[model samples]
Target: MTTWNLNGMKHHLFFCNGGSCTKKGAEEVVEAMRDEIKLQEADVRIHTTRTRCQGRCEDACVITVYPEGVWYKEVTPEIGRRIVREHLVGGSPVEEHISYTYEDELAARPDTKEGQSKTKRKEAQTK
Candidate 1:
């Protein structure tokens, strides 16, 4: 097995650049985030990643901040900057834009039977 090291990084920001997210301006968000991080001078501490898909297309332009496992959805360029400045630089997550936590993502695994059952139940209730 290959060992991967984080080089003492405190946080990892993953910006989804998949099909849906791309259409929603994921690239612009990435640029804005990078600019904000640079302006805040936190480039050495936080790592940024561009990923293909996070399996949350409905919430396209999704951004996941790891180590804390915070997931923000429908992120625009402005929100991306806030994520860098507020969450990464200030050490406080911007709670208003958060769609779910890492725990919520795990529990909503649509591929699993339990998850599917829950989804169906929720749909039924709505109908």
Candidate 2:
């Protein structure tokens, strides 16, 4: 395996390839994203990783972009390409597909499916 030197990179994207995400067509999304990156000549400005379950199966095909902590869900190949074209390159996030983002803490994007339980269990809360 080749170790990467992430120097001068602007963003790191984690593409979920867990069972649920795969079932939802993550492979196509991944390929589309990669191809778009190459087509747009952003290989050095961004890095991508294939990850296991991000615990957001309800939002299958989830993708997380770091340095900004923005998460996008239910991504199709077209949206995957757009994420590379718009967000990674154009300096603006794609609003409609966003699932979560970080602003001091992880904040869910409005109207997105819950990635965690809406209510904490009483016993768990006690801990």
lDDT of each: 0.81, 0.85
lDDT of 1 by residue, 1-127 (tens): 1216667678888999999999999999999998888888777788888899999898888999988787788899999999898888887878767766555345433443445434565687799
> What would the TM-scores of all predictions be?
0.75, 0.83
Indicate the residue-level lDDT of 50 in model 1. 89
Residue 18, candidate 1: Cα error in Å is 0.6
lDDT of 2 by residue, 16-80 (tens): 99999999999999999999998998988989999999998988889999989988988999999
Question: Which number leads on TM-score?
Answer: 2
Query: Cα RMSD to native, each candidate?
Result: 7.3, 7.1
Top candidate (lDDT)? 2
TM-score of 1: 0.75
**Given candidate 1, what's the lDDT at residue 3?**
17
